[model samples]
Target: MQKLSELDHQRRIRLVDLHEPQFERDYPHIDRNAALAALHGELPDGQVLKGLDTSHRAWSLVGRGWLTAPLRWPLLRLVADGCYRLFARHRYRISLWLTGRARCDGNRCGPKT
Candidate 1:
């Protein structure tokens, strides 16, 4: 499994913090279900918040409404085999969305507060 990078983990944490309240109110009954789903298996972003993996290449998992803010539904590894075919390659530049690496000049994707 690809290790979760600092930026990625932090991004998830931020998203979780923002959504915890909604979870409490709207899906109060499904907290257990959500946790269960995340733990039991990997799903698409549009399917659930957990398990879905992102890549510099293409979606390791993809769904119809996956790119939206509130992912509409959960999707599984339907995009894996040749999933890389879906997107243009993204040679991740720490400078593009992260910084402080040897390949970067500290120009962009600077340190977070």
Candidate 2:
């Protein structure tokens, strides 16, 4: 019964889990145009700017993920995925808090309710 019950939470958790690391790995590369789009709610359209994301940590940490889900298609999706990488920021990384650096959940995420 324990296994069966966890199975349900598994789906929802997995949905977030499955996409987390993919974002973490690709976050550093979030381009400038993408950053501007995130900031202004509009794409570069025709601008040619580079080096937009020198500090990927800021948006990924303070910013929210679901807010960027609308862009989950084509090139824009990559930017959305960058949001996930925010969790990987060194300050929030699991190892920084945990003793052995093992698995992390709601408890490990931050202060408890």
Candidate 3:
């Protein structure tokens, strides 16, 4: 997310961390559980877009439009969506393995009491 923000030279993208207390208050229209479970984007018009749709739009804003342009093809889009789902499903474990910790703060990723 930091990398993407840096690439967004125009400052058009606003990356909100789902763990923030103000998230629910700020985006009451979005489902907290659903947003926590996957990637989500709240457009300026208040539309809550999710998953690969949000990703492509964000990438385009960061000047990496070519990265998701392949999704314009129906077949490629289907395949990419499937892959994204797979990754999202296991993201926590993957992050732990890669970073030696979850991507989120310890309180959020730690075992519930």
Best by lDDT: 3
- Cα displacement (angstroms), candidate 3, residue 13, comes to 0.5
TM-score of each: 0.21, 0.23, 0.84
Greater TM-score among 2 and 3 belongs to 3
What's the lDDT for all of these models?
0.33, 0.36, 0.80
lDDT of 2 at 16: 16
Q: What is the lDDT of residue 13 in candidate 1?
A: 27
Better of 1 and 3 by lDDT: 3
**Which is superior by lDDT, 2 or 3?**
3
**True-vs-predicted CA distance for residue 65, candidate 2, Å:** 12
Q: Which order, best to worst by lDDT? A: 3, 2, 1
* Each candidate's clash count: 4, 1, 0
| Top-down TM-score ranking | 3, 2, 1
Across 2-99, the per-residue lDDT of candidate 3 in tens digits comes to: 68888999999998877678988988888877876678997888887788888888999888978878975698888988888888888888988987
